[model samples]
Target: MTKPLDLKHVALSDLHISLLNMRHKPKTTKGRSNEPILDDILPSIRERGIRQPLLVRPEPTKDNKNAYGIIAGRRRYFCLQAIVSEGGEVGGVPVCIMNADDDAQAIEASIIENMARLAPTPMEQHTAFDKLSKKGKTIAEIASVFGITTRMVKQRLALGQLIPVLKQAYTDSEIDNETIFALTMATKKQQKDWFDLFSTDEYTPTGEQLKAWLSGGGCITVEKALFPMEDYKGTILTDLFGEHDQFADIEKFWSAQNAAISVQADEYKKDGWRDVFVGDIGRHFPRYDYAQRTKEQGGNVYVQIGDNGDVHFHEGFMPKEEAKRIDAILHKKPDADSNASNRPEMSGPLLEYMSLHRHSIARAHLLKHPKIALRLTVAHMLTSSGNWKVERDYQRTSKESTDLSLTNSRAEQELATERQAICELLEYRCEHFQLYQRYSSPFNIEDVFGRLINMDDNSVMRIMTFCMCETLKNESGAVEAVAVLTGAKFEEYWVPDDGFFDLLRDKSVLNLMVKDIAGKSTAEYALTDTAKSQKQIILNRIAGQGVENPSPNWRPKWASFPSQSYRGKGSVF
Candidate 1:
C-alpha cells in the first residue's frame, strides 16, 4: 500500500508541510534565512533560484513501506511546491541526503545548518536554546554555536522565569510580557500590588503598555487623565464650615488633626483607579478611606518614606505563620520608643518592611481576597476626593535615610507624655473658618492639615495654664505654681525627682507642651498624653529614640482628611 521509493513527486496538493513539525523546527525559517528577508529576496529568488538544496530522509510509511521525513529545509520544500504548482519545470529539484543521530541530535544538526546562514531573532534563539537545553546542551555550547555571550543567553532565559501562576495569567490573557518583566524587576510587594490592581480587567493589554503601567503605576494613565483639563473641575473649598460657636465647640473635629496619613492592609490588594470615601469622625473616628487597584503589575508591595527622609522598604504579603514570628519579636522590646530594635525590624514602621503582608503567589492560589498587609485603621472617611488614584511610582531613594533610633516609656513619663499630647491637642483652635464658594475636598489632604494648622502646642499650654490657675488658686505658692506651670518648681510633682509633688502637678496644664520634652530627664518632666500622642510620632520617627522595641505601633504619619462638598446641591454628611 505504501511506496518504497527514496523520492516521489506528487502534485503540490498531494504533499502538505506538517504544521506541528514546522512549529517544532529546530530552525526558524523566518530567521537565519540566508535566502534573505522576503522583502529583499523577493526580486532575486523570483529572478534566479534557491541556491541551497533541501534536506530530507527516507522514512517508513505507516501503511507499509518507504517514504521520506523532512530532516530540514522546510522553506525549500515550500518553495519547490509553489514553483511546481505554477507549472514551472521543478521536477528535478536538488535535495540533500542526510542521516540521523538521535532525534534531538538530528534537530540540533538542522538548527546548526540554519544558524550558519544568519542568527535568528531573540525569540528564535530562545526556542533553540530550550530545545538544546532539553537535549542536554550547555549554555556555553549554545552560546558558542550561536556566537553570543552566555549573559545574553541568560537574560533571554530570564524572560521565561515568571511564576507558574503568572505564566498562566499570560496564557489566559490576564497579563502580558512587559508586565511580567516589571514583576520580575520588582523588589517589593507594594510594587507588585500596583500592577496587580491595575491589570484587573477583562481586556487584553499589549505587553509594552503593560510594562509601562507596571513601572510607572498611574503615570501613563494620569497623563491621559490630565490631558482633558476641561473635564477636571477643581473647586478649591476655602472654608465651608465657618469658625462657629456651636459646631466648633461641640465637635472637636476642627481642632485636631495631623499632616499626611496613610491607609493600607495587612494583605496587599490590587488598587489602580479608585475613589476615596470619607466616613463620619466621632463615631470614634469619622474618617476617609484611601483605596486603589492595580491591574497591570503584580508581585510585591513596598512603601518607604521615613523620618529625616530616610527611606525604608516593605515587602509584599506575609503568611500567618510568618506574621506570628513577627509578633513574638514585639513582646520583649528593650526601650519604650519601640523604634530602635532590630529583632522587631521585620514588622512595623522601619527601613525594611518585609513581613506585614499576608498574601503571596503561593497563597493567592487559595484565596480570592485575603487580608491585605496594611489598611489605615480609620473610621470610614473616604470623601470622593480621598479616593486618590495611582498617580505614579518611583524607586525608593536609598540615600534619604538618616540612621537614627528611639526608646520606650516609663510609667510616670508615659503619663506625662500622654498629658502633653492632650494639652497640645487642645491648643488647636479655629481662629476663623474661611467661607468657601463650594464644599468638598479638591486635593487629597487639605482638610486634615487645615485643622492641624490651628493647633500650636504652646497655644494649648497657655489655655491649660489659665484653667489650672483657677483650679488651684486656694493651694498656696509652690503647690499652685506646680499645678499651673509645671516648670522647675513644678518639676518636683510629676517629674522623676518630683515624685512627692507629682500628685499636685498631676493634671498641671504645662506638662503637655513640646517645650517640656526638651530635657533628657524625662523623669523630671512626664510627657502629657496629648504631648505623647502628637510628638511621639515625630520624635520616634525623626528624633530617633533609644527604645528597644523593634516593632513600634505603625502610627502612619501622613495626615490627610477628606472634605465633602455641600455647595453642589448636596448636604454635608
Candidate 2:
C-alpha cells in the first residue's frame, strides 16, 4: 500500500504542484516586490539551469494525484513553471525528493532550511521558537540548535510575550532595547494605563526613568525599617531568589513607622534632652551648627528612625546658641572654692574646678572666631601639630640624613587615599584635577573653598557625618551613632594589626577592650603581665596565633564611652 522511502530516489522531473499544501505559507512567499522576482531571476537561471535542486515531498492522492509539495526553493519551482507556461526550451528541473509523512513535518523542514540560511522576521522567529519551547525544548538546547546565546533566546522569548500590537511595532523597529526591557516588567493592565500616552506622545521614558515609573515609589526592606514587626499592618513580597523581602504596602508601613518614631522622639524630649530632631522621609540626619562642644554644654542628641525599625541614637552634639549659653555657665568661676588652699580638698574636684576656668576662657575666644578656629583645627589635623600631634618626640641620637623625598612620598600616598575614598563616597567628579594636588593649585583651592560654599543642606549633612566620624575627639558615642545610621562599620573593613594596637597607651582601656572581645579569663591573664607583654598577648589573640584557646565567635566591637562615665554624681555644670 505504501512505497519504501529511499534517499537515492532523487530525480529531475516536476509533477503537478500541490496548491493545498502551499496555501498555508503566504508569508514565506517569493519576494517583497509587487512585480514577480522571476523577471530578474530568469536570465541568470537560464544560463545556470537550476544548479541547486528543489526539496519536494510526496503528497497523498486526494489533493492532486502524483503531486509533490515544494518544501524549499519556491523561487526555482516558480521559475520552471513560468518557462513551461511560456512554451520555452527548458529541460526537466532537478529536485531532491523527500518522503515527509505529513504537513507539519513538511512545514518544519521548510522552516529549518530558511532559518539556517536566512534571518527570519521577529514574528516568524517568535512563532518557530514558541513551538519549539511548547514542544519541551530547554532554553539552552534551543540556543544550541539555533546557534544563539541563552540570553538572546531569553530576550526573544520575552519579546514574544509582548501583546500583538507592541510586537508589531517591534517588528517594524519602532521600540528600542531599553524600552523593551522596561516594558517587559509592565503587565497588560499597567501598559493599558499608559496606552494613550504610549500611542500618541512623541516623548517616552526609556531607561531608569521608565523602570522607576513602572516600579512606583519602590520598596522598603526589612533591615531598614524603624517600627517593630508587631506594628507593621501590611504584607511583604519576596524577591525571586528569596534573598530579600520588601514591604508590599509601602505607604501603610511608613505611616505606622513614622507614628511610632514621633512617639519615641516625644519620649526623649520629655526625658529632658535639650532638643530632638526627627529625620524626614528619604533624607539624611540633620547636622547641628555647633557640633564641637565640651561635655558641660549639654549637647543636643539626634535620633534617626529607619523605615525598617532601625533606631540610631546620636549623642553629644548641640545647636550653636545652646552651646554658647552652656559655655557661659561652665566658664563662670566657681566662687574661688572656699577651701582652695586646703591640701586634701585641693587634690580632687577643686583642681579640676580651677582648671576648667582657664580652659573655658580660651574656648570662649576660639568660639568667638570660629573661622580662624576651623583653620587652626584643619592645620592641627593635617600636619599633626599642636595637641593633635601624637608621634613620640625622641632626641636625634644618630646622624641619619632626613630624606625629605621619602617624607613627601608618604604624605602624598595618605592624601591620595583619603581623596579617593571621599570622592567615591560622594560620587563627585571633577575634570582636569588631581585629587592629591597641593594647596597652591587652583583645584585644591576650589576643593576647600568651593565645597564649603556650594554644599546644600543634604551635602552639608553628609560632609558633617564624615567630619564628625573623623574629628570629633573623645566622642565615641557620636561615632557609633554615625556608623549605625550610615551602615559604615569600621571593624568590617579595618584589620586590627600591631600598628593599630601600638596607639593604645592606656593599659586599663586596652584590658577592658580585650575582655569585651576575648573574655574575662584572657584579659585577667594579660593583666598579670607587663603592659608590653599584655599588648603582645592581645595582638596574638586577634591574629588567631600563639593562643591555646582562642575566643570563639569573636568580633571586634569599638568602644563607645557613655557620657555618664565622664561625669561625677551630684557634680554641677
Candidate 3:
C-alpha cells in the first residue's frame, strides 16, 4: 500500500480551496462564483479558533513552493478569512496532508470530513454517493471509505432514484425526512400520482399519514416493538413486495407490551423511585403539570403508553406543587403556597381548646393546694407577673355551644360552689356579683378585713387561695407551670363531649386519638372514614357502648398538666 498521511501546521496564507471540496460552491447556484455562507461558523472561529484540523493535499505553485489545497473544512477556511479581514488575530491552521496525485481520494476524504462535522442534506449525500458509484466504486467500498455500513450506503444511493421535482423540494426543506423516507417506499407510478396531487392546492398527507397511505391502515411495523420479538406468540405477517413486516394480532401485541411496561415500572420503583404512575393507553402524559427533578430528591416515574402499543418511561419527575416546595427548601427561597412552610401543626381552635382546658385544671388544683397557691401569689406579686391585678379570666369562647359546655363542666360547678361558700364566710353578698367581675360586691373593704381577722387561719388562707385561683389569666404560661407543679389530675376533672369533638378538625390527630381510645385495628379501619365517623367511634368506645372495653376515664393528651399536643405544636407549656 500507501504511506500513512502526514499531519502539519500550515500557515493560513498558503491554503487554497481544492476543486474536490464538496461544499466549495452552492449546488443550486450554477454559473455563479459566490463564496459559501460564513455566518454560522464565523463567531465560533473568533472565539474558540479552529478545533479540528483541515484535510489538504500538496499542490505545485508558480512561485516554486508547495502550497496546500483544502479538500475539507472549506467553511472553516472562509471563516478564518473573514476574521483576518476584520483585523482579528489567527494562528497557523492545523492540516492533515494527503498525496498530491489522488483526485478520487481527495473527494472521498472531503465527503467523510463534512459528514462527520455537520450532517449534510440527504440530497447532497445522494449526489456525492452517486458520483462515487459512477467512478466504478462498489457500494461496499464506498461504505468502507466512509466507515459506515453497506446498508446505509445503499439507502443513501436510493434517494438518487427520486423524481427531480421531489429532489428540489427536499433540497428546499419543503418536505421533511420522514415524508421523504415514506415516499421512497412508493412505486414510481404511485410517486407520480402523489406528485400530481401535490402540485394542486389540495390537501396532501405527510409524515405518519403519508406512511399510512403508503401501507394501508392498521399496519403496525415490527420495528416499533418495545418487547422481545421472540416472546410474541401470534402470527407475524410479511409484505414482501413492500418490504414491511407487521404483527397480525393486535390484542396479543398489547398484552405483551403492557406486561413490559409493568416490568419497567417495577424496576424504576426498585431503583428508588418514590412513585410509578402508569397512564391510560392513548392518553398523552401532561408534561406541563410536572417539574423535572433528580432521582435522589424523591422524584417519581411516569409510564406513558401510546395507542400504537409503544411504551415510554419518563423518570425523575414530580408534581408541580411538590417540586416547588422541595426547590424552595433547597434553594432557601420562600414558597407562599406551600402548606408545609411556616405552618403550625395544631390549628387555632385546637390551641384555644388546650389553653382553656389547662387553665381550668390549674384553677381546680390550686383550690386544694393552699401552700402552692400562697407561693404562686407571692411570686406574681413580687414579679408583677401575668394579670396580677386581681383580674379574672373572661373565659371567652368562639362558639356559644363551647361556652355552654364549659359553663356546665364539673370544674366550673365546683369553683362556683366554693365561691358561694367563700362569700358566705366573708359575709359579703350581692345579686350582681359574678366570678369574672372585680369589686362587684356591695360590702366595703374595711368590713371584709374585719371579718377575715376574726376567722381561723386555715379559713382565711382558703379564702385567699380562692381569690388567687379566680384571678389566674386564661392563656398564661404561668398557669400551665402551676398546673404541672400542683400535679393536677385531668381524668378526675374532665371528660370528652360533643363540644370538644366538634373542635377536633384535623383527621390525623383524630385518628391518633382513636388509636389511643379504641384498639389499633379499629383506628386503622377508621382511618379512611370521615372526621364525623371517627368522632362517633371515639364516643362509642369511651361510653362503653357497642365496644368490649370502656375508656370512660380516658382524657386527651392536651387535658393533662404541662399539656402535650397531639400534633406537637402550639402548646403553651
Candidate 4:
C-alpha cells in the first residue's frame, strides 16, 4: 500500500516555481515559516544560486500542471522566483523527489523539516494545528503527528479562540501568558472594556489587580459569608472555574441580614440589658475596648453587622462605676467598703514620693544643661516685665479705640506681626493645627531656629525648655500653683471655641470635666450616655446653659487636650 522512495536516484534538476501548487501550505501569515521576505536568505541565494534541493512529492490530479507539492526548502523555490521577477539571471531549483502516496505524508514531512530548522511561534503552531483540524484530523491524531501533548494542543486551541486584538497583543509582547489566561476567563464585552482601559488610560492594572477588577470587588465567596445561605435573600453566582459562589446583590443581602440583627438586638434589650447599641451596617465595634463590662453590672450590649452579612452580638459592657457596683453586689460586700477599696490607697503620699524622685532626677539632668536653665531663668525674669502688661492691655482694647489709642495700636500690630513670623519659621499652619500636633515627633526645634539664624542644638533646646515651663491645672491645688508660678489670672486669656469642643469627643476626658466642673451627678449621667450626647452636654455646660451657676471663665490652660502619655525607656527630660 505504501510507496517507497528511490533515495539513490535523487538528482539535481531544474524546475519552475509557482505559488498555486503549494496548496498544503497555510494562507495565514501566522502559518508561513518565512513570511513577507527572508531578507537573510535572499542575498545568499542570489550569490550561491540555490544550494539546498527542494523536497517535493507528485501532486494529486486536482493540482496544477507543475504536478509537485513542495515538502521542504520553500526558500530555494521563492528565491529563484524573486530573481526572475527582478529581471535577473535564474534557473530551475534542485529537487529531492519523494514517492509519497497521500497529502498527509507530504504535509508531515514538511512539518518535520520546518521544525528541525527552527520551531514556529506559538501563534504559528496553533494556526497550523487549526488548519489540520479543519482538514478532518482529530486532536489526538494531530498531537501524535506533531509530537505534542493533547492538553497542549487544547490550550493552544483555546488561545486560538481569543479575540483578535488580544492575539495581536500577545504576538507584540504587550501582555504575558498569565494576563492572557485571565483575559480568557473574561467575557467578550469584559475583554473589550479592559482593552479600552489598557490602551487609553494612564493607569492600567495587570495581573492580580486586573483579575480583582474583572471579578467585582464586593463579590463574596460562600465560605466568607457568615449568614446562612438559606437566609440570604438575594441570588448567588458561581465563578468560571466552578471554584466558588459569590453574592449576586451584596447590598440587598446586607439589608435583609442587618434587619434580622436589629431584631436580635431589640430582643436583647427586652431580656433585661441596660441598653443595646447596634453598630451601623459595615461598622464593627472594637471588642477589646467595649467588652470590659460584665453582665451583673447592668452593662450595655453592642451589636455589629459586617459587610458579608455577618452578625456579632457583644453583650455586657458598661462604664467603670456601674461595673464596680455589680462587682460589690456579686461579692456581697458593703458599698462603703467597696468604694474605699476602689479609692487609691495612700495615693497622695505615693504621688508625692514619685514626684520628689522625678523632680530630683530632672533637676540633676537640667544641671548638666546650664544653658537651658539660664534661658528658663531669663524667660521667668521677662514674665514680670512692663512689656507683658502693655501687650495685654493692647490685646484687650476694642478695635474702635485703635483710632484714638495710636501708641497701643502700633505696639500690638508690631508684636502680632513678629509672633506670626516666628510661627511661619516653624512651618506652622493654623488651618492644619491637628496635623501639626499629630506629626510633632518629626519636628526639630533646631530646624525651626536654623531658618532664622545659625542656631545650635544647645540654643534651640534652651529656647524650647523655657517655652515648655508652664503650670498646667491638672490637680486640686493647680490654681494656687499656677498663681505662684506665672503670676497670671486663669480666666484672663482663654475662651471656648469649635476646636475646644471638638477635643471633648474623648469620653474619658469629657467625663472628668463634668465631675470636676459640673458636679458628681452630671458626670454620672454623662458616663452612661453615648460619647456624642456627652460632648453636647459638656458644650452646654461650658456655655453656661442648663446647669445651675455654671462657671463661664472655666477655660483650661492647655491650648489643646493632652495626648495620651507614653513613657519610653529613654529619659525625655
lDDT tens per residue, model 2, 234-321 = 7664322223455656677778777877887787678766667766554545542434332344555567655344566565567767
lDDT of 4 by residue, 1-573 (tens): 656553322222234322222223443544545443556567777888776667777554443444565677665667777877888866555677776455555556665555533334566566666766776788899778765568767666666657889888887688876577666656688788888887985787676455555656554556655446788776664343223555656666666566666677778878888888877868956533432444455668877766554566766676556556666778884566544656666689899999899989998998897665654443332232323211112223354333334433443355445445444534443221211222122223343323424444554454343233322222435534544565554344435554456445666766666676777866774475556556555555554443457576665434222212222233111
Error of 4 at 571 (Å): 58
Identify the superior model by TM-score, candidate 1 or candidate 4.
Answer: 4
Residue pairs with backbone atoms closer than 3 Å in model 4 (clashes): none
- C-alpha local distance difference test of each model: 0.37, 0.54, 0.73, 0.56
Which tens-of-lDDT digit does each residue in 1-573 have in candidate 3? 988989878888899887667666544443544576666557657899998799899875786376888999888888898889999878889998999887778778788666544455667777778777887889999988765667777777878667877877787687787677667666677678778888799998886676556544444677768789988887774433234566667777777877777888888888888989999978887766776566787878887877666667877778889888877788996666776667687899999999999999999988997765654553343223456444566788789659978888898998888888876776543222343333332233444545555677687678767777877787788787777889888778878876888688898989999898886977775676667767767765665554556787888888888678877686735
Those runs of model 1 whose alpha carbons end farther than 4 Å from true positions after fitting are 1-47, 57-66, 113-119, 158-180, 183-573
**Cα lDDT for residue 350, candidate 3:** 100
Q: Which ten residues in a row have the lowest lDDT in candidate 1?
A: 373-382
Model 4, TM vs. native? 0.34
**What tens digits encode model 1's per-residue C-alpha lDDT throughout 1-573?**
523324434332323232212224334332443232233233344456655555555444565344445555555556665556667655444554445334555455555544433233344455556767777878888666544567766655554555545544654455544455444433345344654565676553344344333333211221212123243333211111111111111112111111111233222343541222222332221111211112231223333332111222232223345445655786755676657665643445543334324435545653553221111101012122334321111122333211110112243344345445443453321112111102332222344334433545454344334333323333245443463454332212221211222222323332332233333343222333333233432243222332333223222111101112313333222
Q: Is candidate 1 or candidate 2 better by TM-score?
A: 2
Q: lDDT: which candidate is best?
A: 3
lDDT score, residue 47, model 3? Answer: 91
Ranking according to TM-score, highest score first = 2, 3, 4, 1
| C-alpha RMSD by candidate, in order | 33.4, 25.3, 33.1, 30.3
Sorting all predicted structures by lDDT, with the top scorer first, yields 3, 4, 2, 1
Count clashing residue pairs per candidate. Answer: 118, 12, 0, 0
